[model samples]
Target: MSQLISIPESYESLNLTHINIAHHPPQSPTATPIVILRLNRPDKNNAFTPQMGESLEQAYRLFHLDARVKVIVLTGAGRMFCAGSDLDIGFDDRVERAGDFRDTGGRVALAMHRCSKPTIAALQGSAVGVGMTMTLPAAIRICHEKSKYGFVFTRRGLTIESCASFFLPRLIGMSKAMALITTGGVYPGLSKYFGELFTEVLAEGTAVLPRALEIAREMAENVSPLASYMSRALMWQGPTSPEGAHLLESKVFHHMAGQSDYKEGVNSFLEKRKANFLCDPYEMSPGDYPWWSEVDIRVGPKASKSKL
Candidate 1:
């Protein structure tokens, strides 16, 4: 039961009606903010429908925009994580008006990719199809030791969606990505090929979320929010070359030095205390935080120009 909560002016533009948002307060006396965005369709193991995709995209948008939120933990409710796309609904009807609207999960994936917050995906159970790919955008993935993951697109007679082609190879290498996709097999977190993807695997499903929240709390309480956001943006941008990344890094470094939080960050270390980061991303990031070209992470293929 997610209550309609008030948003800071910076985040007022987006609606939060769809997702279950759990605001977990700081554990220590002065820790930073933490929020959990749970995929709520538990009866079906939180299988994602078109409506869920819309809600997920919107929820991610809200999380990124909210200055008060420092870290985000994305997981499903109950025993399972996500079971992937739901087949029961009629989603094809909108494709005529929307055009090539087949990839609903891609929208949510794109939204998550654009978010600057440090994200943790807590996979309490098996994650199949889009369930597995959707989490690739998140920086950290924590799964239970018993949890299984599948890239079952080929087996299902469906093409891969949610930009897995772009992210999977980068994460596990092209050869591994090809082998796994071709096999259309499900592997546990402990499996050699897929082990690298998980940050850590806990003993049971119940421990996954708690451990993830613990990690989020650690980063939120001690890290500089502005630096985290900017650096995270750079990491995911995938610039053209090493020189391009270097340019982005240097620009962000210079930009951060000018902010007031820089002084506070230094002073807090000297004073032997936790630095209170007041500089929201909306307020402090450089002129071009999203320096990457729009073409890079946008969902769907480039539109073909109609020859008049």
Candidate 2:
């Protein structure tokens, strides 16, 4: 019999106060785990400050390193998911120090995109500007039926963040994307027809967190950690020839096979027991998913009330 190598069961404790970050950790331990990150400043309607952005970056980095965190569920603390930037402080002045301001959205988008694990944005209310752009990179998006989504960039005399230039059109179609971006329009049913933006739209006043956690639990329970990681990477890589994808698959397969978790997974399946995978699949390499193609676009009937 081969010797089993044990992995760490918990993360190293650190002082996060120094960074000015706050969070409510997970409540239970399950094979497949979900980490919920809420925007904690509800008094301000969860408006994001520069420091909050830094803190968020730190939190994401921690999640990236922790082997136990598989899926992530992000939401706001109060009525709003995010109201965009805090008008009191200018995010532009901090742009040079914060990296690409024009591509600021893209940078964060890359972080979410590159994460080995899947992410879900549970939007209950308003998600505007940076808030909306951030959700673009998530693997799944669940929004309430009454939830409102807005581009709101042109109205503020700012450009879109992240690689929204590349992502939005792909999800909503070029014509729709153009109108939304240029007009800074808000939409209620846009996510319904544009499946790329959101997978499910629930009833009004539905609680998004519970549903998100439910999904995270399902994914953690049924999917193979190794296979899930590789599949996510493949999807992120987008559409490629079988031969090309196969080459990438070969490397991931060999790497997974050598891990102790792989052996445990196979053994557990045969024994009709749950696999105890110590590492979270979200920490693995990201998959390649398809980008949108340029096609002729059309507009749906305009609503009586203008989405401003």
Candidate 3:
């Protein structure tokens, strides 16, 4: 049975116009915070709008800057997660030149990608086009077994957006990614073409968000925020060679070993108690923490500067 999802009395709300930001406190005082970012346009199947995209990007940037937030859960408000872009509203007509235009969906994806906090996507129902691509940056995705998903851009005679081309292949494999884009067809959450895209699939749509929250709460309580973020970054940007990987790992370990979290981890292990890790990895990163070069998706290459 799908359980009721009630926000505890202690939770705080940001009450943003396009999206809802809920600040969920941890069970223990020492644990890190969890934030839920939900798409609020339930009336339109939570259709993607320029305002919604801006709100999402803002929330992600806030999460990146705030040390209090450890985990983020992305979900939609109603029966359908999102039915892709709000086609009636159409694309932004503000741009004067095509060369200067930047995709809002891509900007949202970039924000999510840049954020260090681990994100979990709770897909309670079908998600199409930009809706599907937005969740690609999340570390984990939990979905309803009956919920459908689609790339859908080709069917609409539109190209893919939201950095899907890069993340999709790396996540599911090149062949599967190619298939999804080529056909632009809707498929169930458990479809063979999707492979292992969803980390967990629950039978009930109502159960999906709750299951994601359960996992997020567990992570907030037991996992080190710093370690989790770094581990993800390492996997996504690690060196290809064995020797390079070994050297990089050694360097990172040496730096981390001197931090407060390492001592707390060791002492807690020895004392048979839960660890109270308080280190902020972003603030205390190694001199060369982000070894790879970063691309600025916001601007053209000629005008862009390296993030690293």
Question: Which lDDT value does model 2 have at 226?
Answer: 53
List the candidates ranked by lDDT, beginning with the highest: 3, 1, 2
Q: Per-residue CA lDDT of candidate 3, range 1-308, in tens?
A: 95533323332444456688776553433323787788989999999999899888877776776777788999999899988999999767477567778888988898898787889999999999999999999999988888899999999999998989889999999999999999999999999889899998889999988888899888876787777877787888899999988988888888888888888888888999888878775687778978899865454546447686
TM-score of each: 0.85, 0.73, 0.88
Better of 2 and 3 by TM-score: 3
- Which one is best on lDDT? 3
**Backbone steric clashes in candidate 2, count:** 19
Tens-place lDDT per residue, model 1, 1-308, is 95564444433233443347666763323222787788888888888888888878877776776777889899998877998887787344464445545477888888888776778999988899988999998889999887888899899887788999988888878888887789889988887777478889888889899999999988888888788878777766757799987877888899999987899899999999988888888677789756755764433667679876
Instruction: Report lDDT (Cα) of residue 70, candidate 3.
Output: 80
Better of 1 and 2 by lDDT: 1
- Model 1 gets an lDDT of 0.79
Off by over 4 Å in 3: 1-15, 25-32, 298-308
Task: Point out the worst 10-residue segment of candidate 2 by lDDT.
Answer: 15-24
Q: How many residue pairs clash in each candidate?
A: 0, 19, 0
- Candidate 1: TM-score? 0.85
lDDT of 2 by residue, 1-308 (tens): 95543333432232332122222244333322566667667777777666666656565665655566677788887787888777886664643233323343454676676666677888877878888887887878888777678889899998887668877887778877887788887777345334457777778635677788788777776666556656665665544788877776776677677767778888899999877776456443334322235332232343577668
> What lDDT score belongs to each candidate, Candidate 1 first?
0.79, 0.66, 0.84
